[model samples]
Target: MRAGVTLRSYASRYWEIYNKISGDNERVVASTFRMGLPEDSELRESLTKKPSEGMWQLMGRIEEYKRLEDDRLQSKSKAPMMNRPRQTGFPFRPRGGLTIQKPTAQMGEVNVTFEEPVHRILDWIKHEPYFRWPNKMGGDPSRRNQNLYCIYHQDKGHTIEQCQVLKDHLGQLVKVGHLKDFVLDPGDRVVG
Candidate 1:
């Protein structure tokens, strides 16, 4: 088979995989085939499948096409979007207060101290956005905390009185410069 014929056949197969993975337009596949690099003969032989040289060449071309398409999709997906809303979640506030402990790195060198405990809260929020506060009840298998105070004081269990207490406390904290003002705007509400 001619090089053009072999390339076309390989590209068609590659497009099938790409379409399955990305749900991209078929026109994009056709354009990709037209723009893809030519197959190398030595590399083609290394992937020998039998039948004819044309078949081997097609296989090599398909592999190359898959690589290119995958890269293109990845690059496109990773491009940063402007003015994206920041996600809100529980922040890592040091409960017991933070301490700085300098470590000896080299002779006469001090390592910078970071007192924050490494909690998996940020990672958890990223992976599971809908994750509610873990149940504080001991009976709940997924509960992370068993302390009754933590359970009763949680936002989930907040009664009207508790909510008022919380609101007042937060206001006081803001007034005393202990916490920054992070008032929620109406636009922050999520419509389901």
Candidate 2:
């Protein structure tokens, strides 16, 4: 029985490690055996590097291939398929609709007063998508008020008027001139 002789084992980030066995044993191998040294297998038909090709040229080609593979994988994972529906945008609306009710306890009280009602400004700002939406509240559902709904959170628990987070965001926006139209002078009006 003849024993196989491995001349070398090729290893790189571009492909899997393959053994280069001598012709006297079984495979007449090159450093690029899997790429196309045998020249018989259809899958290995694409000869990416030539034996006469320069070392720098081969490295550059391998780098190009790696970049293309990375881009392909990223796009495949991130892009929504054609069969799926596109996202409906931010500040998701509730399914059954919200019931407008006054809060039992005062919340979202800010030192600044607005020329227009806070709810009206909120309606306009939310439609234009000026601010980032708040994440859902985490707590025991039994303790939360099921009757009230917060548009800011798109969940049932608190009313939009009572959302402290929303009020804080709007206050910051007003200070930054994004909501200057909504601000009312403190001397002109008193906050209840």
Query: Best by lDDT, which number?
Result: 2
In the range 101-175, model 1's lDDT, one tens digit per residue, is 211111123221112211211121212222223323234433532211111133222221223343343344334
**C-alpha lDDT of residue 32 in model 2:** 48
Positional deviation of residue 57's Cα in model 1 after best superposition, in angstroms: 1.9
How many Å off is the CA of 135 in candidate 1? Answer: 34
Q: What does candidate 2's lDDT look like per residue over 1-192, in tens digits?
A: 012211111113111111111222112222343443234532233333343244333434434443444355448668422322221112212233443332222224646666764555665575243565666579886798765555556556776667878777787777667877676665776437
Q: Highest TM-score, which number?
A: 2
The true-versus-predicted C-alpha distance at residue 8 of model 1, in Å, is: 11
Backbone clash total, candidate 1? 0
How does model 1 fare in lDDT?
Answer: 0.32
After TM-score superposition, the amount by which residue 126's alpha carbon in candidate 2 deviates from its true location, in angstroms, is 1.6
Clashes, model 2: 0
Off by over 4 Å in 2: 1-110, 127-129, 190-192
